[model samples]
Target: GGAGGGGGRNRGGPGGGPPKASGKKRHRLASLPPSALLARVERRGGGGSFPVHCVAGGKLLELNQRLALEPRLLYDRPCREGYVAILFPSPDAARQLRSRLLSESEYLRVRGLSAEDLL
Candidate 1:
């Protein structure tokens, strides 16, 4: 059983073009702890990289290898075709993670953005 989430995305509109592939990092996921680093997303055109961390502790079910080849999917269709990894968390871990996640309004408020800003 795999769960979705923990994907990287760009902040600008979809006109920046695709990012070039550079040095890649690999992780061994024999066991995943809560807040474990899953992947690092490097900013296009030379900036700092962002770390993608796991939300819960469990096993890694699958990785979307397609992103390695087509990183643009993350900017184009993040929720559809650009997922980073799939994980199967334990019942307790899943519950805890869900409880801590912010709702849509909560997230927008925390970022000092309104719902219309996302549109």
Candidate 2:
């Protein structure tokens, strides 16, 4: 299993940035149903669009709905901008799924082991 670590520059602070939305909207994204389409990652330079389908239950759906409104942001900061949608599933499943995932050290240790030995 592949897991993305959450670590980056904080986009919001006293320095000033985009206007923050209400807490109600944030809560909705943090709790999405199963089988929901999270976001479509579009290629830069008009290459193509790739849909980001969600398999897990819990997710932090942070999609920039205003990508169409301000397409320039997509070009300027593709990493920090331009998401089609977002979705989050059940919390219990998310916990179980994460718990089953092997850490970097564990993966390296077991990577070369035979299937029978792994068990």
Candidate 3:
């Protein structure tokens, strides 16, 4: 199985906004492989549902309960406090993940986004 770990992002949301809380379990204790379903983020007004997946194979450590309680955080500060879950990958998986991650500039270039666009 592929290495699984890391935080997730909600790429599919209304106006490309952050994901809404699914109100599911706050803690997941099962081992998951890469691309496994971690959580589901649904839009408030029946917009659409997005599934948050595991990046690498690992154990789910914790889910951000705050998102479930205060969904505004997802819009106010999506990158900081709106993260969905924490996963601890195996040692080998961690090393593999580090090798696969793109540099900040490379990621920006690939996404066709400039630093100013983020702000």
Give lDDT: candidate 3, residue 31. Answer: 73
lDDT for 97 in candidate 3 is: 96
lDDT of each: 0.60, 0.46, 0.62
Model 3: lDDT to the true structure: 0.62
Error of 2 at 85 (Å): 8.3
TM-score of 3: 0.59
lDDT of 2 by residue, 1-119 (tens): 11112112223223332223223355544544454444444454444554444456555556565764564554444334643344354777778767878875576476543334332
* RMSD to truth, every model: 10.7, 12.2, 9.4
Cα lDDT of model 1 by residue, 7-88, tens digit: 3333211343222222224254446788766666655645555766778987776656676667667655555677667777
TM-score of each: 0.60, 0.36, 0.59
Candidate 3 steric clashes: 5
| Candidate 3 wrongly placed segments (more than 4 Å) | 1-29, 108-119
Question: What value does the lDDT take at residue 82 in candidate 3?
Answer: 67
TM-score of 2: 0.36
Candidate 3 has its poorest 10 consecutive residues by lDDT at 1-10
| lDDT agreement of model 1 with the native | 0.60
User: lDDT (0-100) at residue 15 of candidate 1?
Assistant: 45
Q: Is candidate 2 or candidate 3 better by TM-score?
A: 3
